[model samples]
Target: MTEMSVQLEQIAVRAARGVGDALRAAFVQAQQPSHKRDHHDLVTEHDERTEQVLRAELLDAWPDSAVLGEEGGASGDGAVHWLVDPIDGTANFALGLPFFAVSIGAVANDQLVAGVVYDVMRDTAFSANLHGAYADGEPLRSTGPATDAQNMLITSYPGPGTLAAGRGVEEYTTLLREFGAVRRMGSTALALAYVAAGAGCAYAYGIHPWDVAAGALIVQQAGGRYLPLPDTGRPWEAPGYLAVNGDFDLPGSCLTDLLPRMLPRTATGTPLPGGGLRNRP
Candidate 1:
């Protein structure tokens, strides 16, 4: 890792640990919840507090790096940036479910170089940079393709109607039917981490930069592929995202074949592994 990447890694680790401590405190306190932008999307006191902790830690390490957080608005616009989801799966957390997480990703000049997705309930930290991805300190890699009978797909549920409301929903539904099994886990960061750890084969849905930033780095460093959502055409920010294991083949691979078949094909043509034609950062 470069010195910058190393320094960023330390920041991620510290933030993850701090956020985990915060979540534990919240769970113990049994805090009340509030709504954000809508009722289905929830937030908590801990979420805001955690973001404050992250903002301080992140900006201290990368003074010039832009920071865009779920709770707080964007700050700085340097070539390097920090994208954060202080509390992913807040609905689950508020309901006493255990799938919530804090996701943080670092992007340099539009390219993602590192990220960390910390599962507070489980205390499992998934992180990666240019060097490689690790899960709880052990080097991690993506799972190989499953046999036709074993394939599994994971999803996030804003609600039952959310998917059908989008043009991408039709494609998403078609894949849901084709896959051997489907699961709605309510947490995008954790869903991507499962893909990195080989617990699931692929994941696709609309997600914010904060939701996938850390998980994207984990997926890439784990030897997986992150195909950008075609609509936005940007890496650090996009309306939708897909992540799959690298061991899977391309062209006819589970992800490549499934994505275009479900969502409308991009006007620019299909999105490629690691976002083709679009330059990397």
Candidate 2:
């Protein structure tokens, strides 16, 4: 890893940790979440406040960088871009669930160089740089069962929009019948963090850049596979993704057969129309 990449990784980790206290205090408390695009999409004061905190920390650490946040839009214009998801899984967070996380990833000259996903409830940080990936400062390896039936898969597939699209239900059924077990924990960042930590594989559709930018880099750096479905110029910019452990057999897994049917294709690189719980983050 270059010295600059390592420095960026440290900055990302610290920036994510900076908001832990406020998030912990707000979690499970009575929060009046206002709708963003719809009832399924939610945002709270904490989300906005945390984004501000993260934006300040990141820009302060690297003054020549820009920030693209979920709550707040783009800020600054520099070679380095920071993708920030202040509070991933806001629904779970407001309801007292402990599956949310703070995710930040840095892109230098259009390439993802560093990322950090901090699990506030667990107090565990999953990070990665050009050098390698780490979990709580320890080296992380994305090793798991080799076969689909032997490994656990995490995904929030077949969300409201997907169902409305008329193909998600069948896809969801196939996953249930193929994988050993399937879980929907409502947090894409944490789900990908688990994949990086060797917990399992994760798949999702209809997500935004901030949703997978950090987790995707962490997973790949951990020696896992982070494949952006229907490449949209850049990996982090993809609308959907399928991440697996380092040892997963993608060609043999059912996912390979299902990808074409599940993800929408367009003549242009624009993302297909779909929506899900993870769409907010």
Candidate 3:
């Protein structure tokens, strides 16, 4: 399993970087992206093309593997299942923001064994296998201040889906007050990667399997906490995620109040002391 995971990790890294040149070239030009769910959700030609490129590479590299990609959908039925989001921040990329990424993860035995989150613009890869997490091969650890007031929290919560569910500015405002600062950078994969690379808290609701699979593994491998919201047995089976810096000291944050209301299931686990919960699940 260890050797297989290492091989998969390498395959993910190579596949993610292989399409970089084309993506970078496309990034410079002004291109329009069609909307997916709404104006807030976008899908560009590059996104589709990149996913195709990644899918072909992954399947070719591991013939006995299946791929669940955001753009192209699922293919094959092997033991090692791959989750991929070719362009994680498509809206950001379309709008000329340098925050998108190529994310891929390998799941075997009902567990994440390998993963990679490639920051395309920066050409950086945060990878993890059974051994540990690394940023371009260096050991990486996700740690930050213990108190909310001492660190910066990054989130894209209250997205269109969340807003429709009644989690709007109030929850956002509350998190801002409790945390030293709150930022909405708009990329779940990269945001999770950032958290694993020693950034602050990151959470999201209404995410697909491809969106959080790789980043979740990266966070956990880098010594951070990647909690599937509502405590689903499998993180990808659920629609939400709550990721905290490795040394953030506690299990919950100011965002705790929003989770229960955001998802269909009630949140259950250890109680959150500092996390003010108005809508306790």
Candidate 4:
């Protein structure tokens, strides 16, 4: 990590650890859950409190940076914006599950430069900046070559009906069957963090900017690659994303072929919007 990246990472790590600390304290006593407008979506008092802690810590550390969080809404207009999901898997957390996580990232000039994902239950923190990615302070990197069909694949289904919600489900289904095994962890940020730690080989989902901003930066720093998912003709928005280990070559991987079929396309074979895809929870 360069000097700047190290400094920025420290700021992000402190904020993330603070979120974890709050979660530990607030959740230990049990939580009162409330459903979001969406029936399947859930939140808790802890979520709001954790966001409050994170926002204050981040804002205090970098007052000029804007903050876009799931809880407190968006604030500021700095060149560098911080995107956070106070608890990425609130549904799981509310149900006494340990899959929930705190996700935070710094975006500057439309690029994600640093991020942190803290898993409260395990006290594990995943972080990254221009320097690289880490799991509990241990440097992380994607494992093996990307072509192995036996590689682990992580996806987020949210609810039962959403699996087929995107483009070319049939192709994705085929890919799933071919891979070693598939995991639907419900938490986009944590799933991506696992990928960054080499706990999984690949991960993809229809994710919002807040959900992925941090993890994506971690993946890149950990020697992985990600970009907007190809549009499937639904809408031209910040497309969902597909990511793979940095060592994985598209030429020999199934993803290279699958990407074209899944991306949104025009009647004349033109691609749709490649940026600004945000799915608000």
lDDT by residue for model 3 (236-272), tens? 6566777888888453555555555544334445332
lDDT of 1 by residue, 1-281 (tens): 35577567668877877768758768766758998778888888888888888888888777777789998889876777888998889898888888888898888756777888898988988988778888887899997664423566776533445445555555556656666777888888998888899765555555688988888778878987676665354554765666667665444434555554454334336554454324422
Q: Whole-model lDDT, candidate 3?
A: 0.84
Candidate 1 regions with alpha-carbon error over 4 angstroms: 76-79, 157-177, 231-233, 249-258, 264-281
Predicted candidate 2 versus true structure: per-residue lDDT over 43-147, tens digit per residue? 999999999999999999999899999999999888889999999999988777888999999998778899999999999999999999999899999998888
Instruction: Residues 1-281, candidate 4: write the lDDT tens digits.
Output: 25656666779888888667667666656667998877678888888888888888888888777888887899876776888899998878877777888898887655567888888788988998887899888998866445547566676523344344545567668678767667777788887787776654544544677888788788878987665454443211243666666665545555555555554444214342333222111
lDDT (CA) for every model shown?
Answer: 0.74, 0.86, 0.84, 0.70
Steric clash pairs (candidate 3): none
Question: Model 3, residue 45: displacement in angstroms?
Answer: 0.9
TM-score of each: 0.84, 0.92, 0.90, 0.82
What is the alpha-carbon lDDT of model 1 when measured against the actual structure?
0.74
lDDT of model 1 at residue 75?
Answer: 80
> Which scores higher on lDDT, 2 or 3?
2
Winning model by lDDT: 2
Q: TM-score: which is higher, 1 or 3?
A: 3
C-alpha RMSD between model 3 and the true structure: 3.3
Which regions of candidate 2 deviate over 4 angstroms?
265-281
Q: Worst lDDT window (10 residues) for model 1? A: 272-281
